[model samples]
Target: MKRCGVGSKNQAKLQAVASVFAEVDYDVQGFDVDSTVSAQPFSDEETKAGAISRAKAVLEKDVEIGIGLEGGVMQMNDGLYLCNWGAIADKQNHVFTAAGAKILLPEEIANGLHRGEELKTVMDLYTNRHGVSHEEGAVGIFTNGVISRADMFIHTVRLLYGQRCFYLS
Candidate 1:
């Protein structure tokens, strides 16, 4: 099995990517790299950039692969939505990227964000729970546990791997 390192201290995100990697024969590991990522609230580009940033940062070592995940918000004609982004980097620094699922926020939650609260903070307060981002997350609550933050993140990682697989093949 190949070795994989994920650039995140958060267990949920790490496990999300790791679980996906397991299906592809990688021995997964997590690293808490300071990504210094910035989110533009509703910009998919910036959100994806954060994941790319972490993927590159995690390459400080000789791991066969590195993974990064980021959560972002985007506004649409219907409502605002939460988005997840993922990136995978190879030992030579080639990067592949993708995004996870998105959930439209209820009006009330959108209002709170308009009041200047971050998605993490707003979800915590609205759900009467803390660290929603770390656990199942907003997606979990929105889907009544049918889907979760990790699950959504896993989708992105899988997509990234799919793209990488193409080139290798």
Candidate 2:
């Protein structure tokens, strides 16, 4: 357990990381870093690179461990899916990353994404509210509260932590 620095003070990311380290007696601090937050053409590879880049920035801020959480929408042959990526960077220069569960977006939302709109913006417009990304998010909107943004990333954080706890041990 070490001091953890999160790239964004986003509620979901905070809860996701804190939930994992709750029993470990480690300090978790949240920050609002300036991140691209999305890929240029919208691909998982760029999404992952963004997460790693943000995590490295946080690590440079004197944190023992840095975490990054990025959410994006991916297009498939059949449809679009909401996707999330998470990365962990340690002082040792080791990095581990993972992604949350994805849910296909409704055609309406998919159309917006295809038009170059971000998922959060599209979700906000669809739900007729603001800041949904910081709250329940697309996953929540699709899953009907069965899963939350926080809950979704918690699983991803676990995946990242699993590697950290294993190889870094």
Instruction: Count clashing pairs, candidate 1.
Output: 0
Best by lDDT: 2
lDDT of 1 at 61: 62
lDDT of candidate 1 vs native? 0.82
Per-prediction TM-score to the true structure, in the order listed = 0.90, 0.93
Residue-level lDDT of model 1, residues 22-129, one tens digit each, is 877888888878656553345687788888878888888667888888888888899888887889988776899898778898999889887778888888999898
Please identify model 1 stretches exceeding 4 Å from their true place.
Answer: none
Alpha carbon RMSD to native, model 2: 1.7
lDDT minimum window of 10 residues, candidate 1: 34-43
Question: Can you give the lDDT of residue 162 in candidate 2?
Answer: 94
Q: How many residue pairs clash (N, CA or C atoms closer than 3 angstroms) in each of the candidate models, in the order given?
A: 0, 0
